[model samples]
Target: MSRRIPLPPPPPPAEIQSWPDREARLVDRALAMDELGRRLLGGRRLTLFLVWFVLLELGWSFVGVALTAFDHGQIDPITLMLVMFSTCVGLAILVPAVWMTVRGILRDRVARERLAQWAALDSHPATDARLRAPTLGLCWLLLSFAMCAVGLWISFAVPAGTSREDGGYGFVAYGMGIGLILWITGLVGLTKAVGHYRFAVRLTGRPGPRSASSGHPRPE
Candidate 1:
């Protein structure tokens, strides 16, 4: 059987002075932790899947619009059934997306706590500048905001066609659907990066903690 949780990252150095690119090394080690790895949900692979799904959802709306003949304002029973089925398939993607988002949030919280403990072991502590919100996280947040804007513009401002009589492929609702997926994925990414940074920052400048029994960082 496949393992449920990812393998935890190798231990970070108790003192970072010897490590080259100290901050990057710290981040790499933290991300290797099982919780962070799982929260990514396969990382870039999941991101690619979301992009494909968003495109599929956007196009499916057009399919639905095509199935209905607006000349007489009447719809065929078989066409309506087919359209409904297609729509159901498209919406089903949301189930997994929602699960990932919620699971990621919870996992990030755990990763943050663990990361703090791990960082606290370093004798040469990180500085506040080194612990600021991660750059990748800011990108996630900014991209999400852009997507939200585009989704709104497409839904409300962009004209579907010369006339709204035939619905012009229902771009409004479709854009919003695409936007929702991007928003969820981006939010999760940002949460992980920002949370990790925050946890590390909080421990900066503090004296290293040691267990009574062992001088090393505790195991997960």
Candidate 2:
């Protein structure tokens, strides 16, 4: 009979050496939450700046138009033509810059929310569905905004003489239609991100350190 040699007490249950390293990483991530939130929400001021810029541009455009109307006889034809060209060029540049800024702000907010969701999970790991919800929403937001921007730019570039029957005009129209759909989808995505953030905060029972310093009052 083979002596039932008790398998050497199972080598004292191989100690999980990874727990300390994982815990340390989690701690570091938690600490970074406040800074991340600050960065994420920092773009609010940029949005305000864009609004002011748009108003300023509109005001300037109106003033130029008014002056041109009254000074038609006094102003040289060549000088008036140059002024109009400059205004058009400036407007083209400004529109694209505004779109870029908006897209950037949306992306930043999405990233910040993702980080907050992660930090919240340290104590309360929610369902996988909930975990992915905000990400999907934010992705939609980003993609839709990009599509809308691209479509608008393309439409703007289409020549004035190009008829609807022309391929360029058709392409621009198609792009605009697709962009509209994406814009709607983006709204849905934003709702998902907001809902997920609220849910995650509830799971953790309070805002993390990031939220505390962000100065935005916690959702009631």
Candidate 3:
């Protein structure tokens, strides 16, 4: 006896006709969705990051001042304890600040690339102004200036021979040390912040939908 083999039929004509267009549309939708998601998510994160930065800076300044005050009296156990606590907090804040600064700077670069991609795709112009300007960079610049000023003032205020034993200098020597450190760090921060700002401005062109003077977004 002879055996017969059956061949499977091809897909319907309608299925073939619809597949390519459907797939293309799906891809487009996915890409658009992804861009939107990233924009929204990035904006929220950036805002939160800035707020945390401001709070930390304020806290650090206060702690530093308090430590300087303690240094004037005596290097007692309590003073030592407070100094240690302040140092620990400063170190802790510094770790996260540095991490966030680097992260934000990298994210800014990524955002520039994203803008390029959008332009290439002829997507809608992003109305979110946060992406256009280096907000964190500006904050860093302002903070750096303030820190440098404070450091200079402290340095000038510290007299020679201010020692803990005589309770005359209180924390003058320590103040000078901290002041110098702050000044150096402030200069470094300013340089990096300026670089970031310039790069961001170049990438985004004119500041998006917002005007820089008023710090508010225009009607989109």
> Each model's C-alpha lDDT?
0.48, 0.44, 0.50
Could you tell me the lDDT of residue 2 within candidate 3?
A: 34
The parts of candidate 1 lying over 4 Å away from their true place are 1-3, 7-72, 120-145, 155-163, 166-171, 204-220
Pick the lDDT winner. Answer: 3
**Model 2 lDDT tens row, 1-220:** 2442221111111243242554564554444543344333334433443353454345344334433343334667877777677567655655664564466557555554555444533442333223334544465446545544654554455444445455443344444443443343344334534654564456455433332223332221
Candidate 3 ranges beyond 4 A from true positions:
1-43, 62-67, 70-73, 123-220
The TM-scores of all predictions, comma-separated, are 0.53, 0.37, 0.42
Clashing pairs in 2: 34-210
- Give lDDT tens digits, candidate 1, residues 74-173: 6689866766776566456545545554654565556545544544433343332344435544555566556556655554553443245644445444
Q: At residue 12, what lDDT does model 3 achieve?
A: 31
Task: Summarize candidate 3's per-residue lDDT along 75-131 as a digit string, tens digits.
Answer: 778868777877777767766765665665565455444433332322223432333
Q: Which candidate, 1 or 2, has the higher lDDT?
A: 1
RMSD per candidate (Å) reads: 8.1, 17.8, 15.7
Q: Number of clashing pairs, model 3?
A: 4
Error of 2 at 195 (Å): 8.2
